[model samples]
Target: MNRVDTAVHVEGLRKRYGDTIAVDGIGFDIDPGQVFCLLGPNGAGKTTTIECLEGYRRPDAGSIRVLGLDPLADHGELRRRIGVQLQEASLPARLKVWEILKLFSVLYEREKVPWSLLDHLGLEEKRDAYFDKLSGGQKQRLFVALALINEPEVVFLDEITTGLDPRARHAIWDLIRGIKEGGATVVLSTHFMEEAEALADRVAILRAGKIVANDTPEALMRSIQRDDEVRVHVEGSLDAAAIEAIEGVATASIDGDQLIARGVGRGWIARLVNGIEAQDASLLDLSTRRASLEDVYLALTGEDEYSPESPATEEAGT
Candidate 1:
């Protein structure tokens, strides 16, 4: 078989369930062996889009190719080459861990030693544990093992770390990094800003069934206006325009006695400092903070990251 440079490609993709559009004219590509992250709020069509590429659902419009093959038409070949971890995954309550891994390993011609998969995902200790007996983190680890049991060329991970505690989430992150290092192209879909920032070689931020932003995490954060913030606590009043006049300063504001200066470039800090000193303003305090992916997500979606009202994501297409 010939190896392709692009692991997955989507063009003008569209899907709808009746009047509610699930995905709308979205397009992006994933490079071979790259970790591509799909980031969005719940119901932002992240999973729906991923499912199309995974061959679980056919798009209502547009085209998708995974491993250079049509996901639906070539699903048999595609399924053998791709492994998936769905968002709300669970196994039979009575099934033991090793039994499931052993079962999945045979489904594909390529195989990984069941024990090695157990050790690789830190599930060696749970070999005898029933699926229902494992904790949330343990269950997730087992799922990852099952996903990789086939030694697939491409892996689709949907919300891999959702509901995991901080410690477990970090552990899962390490496992995902290891997956990339092993030469498999990974498509990750998640609402967690930090997960995307930490794992994605490239990210496409989906909003209302369409891609609103697509870039590296750093570039996405940088694209947001007013991202660089430097707070200068002035002993006396300083005109907002005077601070804004400094090169690299995008905007200036007053918060009580503090001058809140937002910078546009790397040199914003130096310019602000020079301008303040020249104005004979004594600095009571000074601190600088840069923007992050979370800021970009909030600005793009107009939704709180920690909002409790987020609906359980229900995908429309298969």
Candidate 2:
């Protein structure tokens, strides 16, 4: 696609701090109204790459464009059309939710009102609450509201829902969908495998400051291996000859009383069932599951060294 048509574009972007190279040569694109998630572990350079795109940090090399403006050279123009929620952002403790929203709105060329933004985020009831008085989830919602106050064309969210409860996390997911539906492109950094699989239209897996893989979640999972697994629980012991009779059945193994058949596609499941019936083996329970994004992440990046903790987790045990 043309660079001009993309909401955010980066090419061979590099960043360094002293002797360390934080962001190596990496590149990607964010399409308009699409949720593009960047996944990586701590010290992987996801943050550095995002900061360069947001114009908060100047890159040592390469190029970046946000809404057709150079992120570093034309930051003033870009800022007018882009909203950002930094990972370390914090508001004054005494500031009321409504006041904080109103303050940030004034920074944008075109702004949405505090109440309207809060209503969209399900934070209308907390509008008058002090920033420090709000819960972790409430603060996250308010941060999101402030980011969108400018009616920006592109929104940058860094670990936005990292510390929320399951209910709150799902709520934020719905809110993110609403943002995409409102014609705004979203670029976010998240370590949550399921979160990327659920919200992102496309994902880029970053490792050591470089993008190792980029594609749809489904495609990535499928690329790992061609084999599909079927779990079958039968009333009695399964015969090896009968199991081998199923078409496309590469292998069958017994784990406790459950028999697992591995092969290609859904056809193997039916063949295995029919073969079992032919042998007079009664079927007890059957289930089929696809490879998830977690499997894909582990295959591509190895297991992450740092397990990201949510804000609530940090707060509760501290």
Candidate 3:
């Protein structure tokens, strides 16, 4: 890929609170117009790293530049150019949707795109509703709309769809894509593996306050060395010798009546079918699949879920 102008850049970023170190020397870059995802389990410092980039918190050690300006030193200039949707955003309970958007718009020198932004976020009809009256998903949409009112050059979305249902989540994902297409860079921190895989151009996986893996989703999936597993259901019992004769068959195992074969690539399915047909055995069903990002996460971090067990453990473990 060509080296585009860097929208956000970090080098050896570190942060600590008293005795606990939250972020430990992490570094990455986001190119212009790219959807860069900071992925990790809870307490992995993904939020802290994002806070540093957003100028919400200062780093103890390291450098951060967003849109060619230092985030900490130039926070005034940086805030004008970036929009942030915090993980736990709150508005006055009685504030109307339009009131909140209009209030935020006044903070920026540029005029807020309230009308188009509200329409795009599906908030046009809810303009008169108070913040407390809206549902979780609707509130999330309103928060996103507020973030984009200023037409920022870079948008930081920290788990923007955490409480949304599947339909609402997909809608927000499409809105995010539209944001990227409109020439703004996006830096999102998410725990959902599918969300990262579906949207991120490149992902940085953080664990224990450090980066464990960083690459495109496809590249990260291919990095795992487990041979692809193909399941073949034969009509009748097949001898082990016949299964071994199939091309690209690394190993074959019989689970009850089904034949499970592990192989390297795509041709294994055809080869297995041909081998079975030659033996006068009918093939019942066959399926081939590769590993997903969830598998990759388990293999690397050894965690089944992203949430931490306890706050005390989270602070102590890191």
Highest TM-score among the candidates is held by which one? 2
Question: Over the stretch 142-205, how does candidate 2's per-residue lDDT look in tens digits?
Answer: 8788778777899988877777888888988998999999999998788788789899999999
Q: What is the lDDT of every predicted structure here?
A: 0.82, 0.81, 0.81
The lDDT, on a scale of 0 to 1, for candidate 3 is: 0.81
Which ranges of candidate 2 are over 4 A from the true structure?
A: 1-3, 86-89, 109-114, 304-318
Q: Which lDDT value does model 1 have at 152?
A: 81
Clash counts for all predictions: 0, 1, 0
Global CA lDDT computed for model 1: 0.82
**TM-score sort, best first:** 2, 3, 1
Q: Considering every candidate listed, which one attains the maximal lDDT?
A: 1
**2 versus 3: better lDDT goes to:** 3
Off by over 4 Å in 3: 1-4, 87-89, 304-318
Write one digit per residue (lDDT tens) for candidate 1, span 1-318: 668989998999999989999999999989999999998877889888988998888899999989899999999888888888844344578888888777666765554556797888888888998888988788878877778876788999888777777788788899889989999999988877888999999999998899989999989987887557788888766778888888888889988889888877567788788898888878888998888888888888886544632343423122
Every model's TM-score: 0.84, 0.92, 0.90
What shift in Å separates residue 86 of candidate 3 from its native position after superposition? 4.0
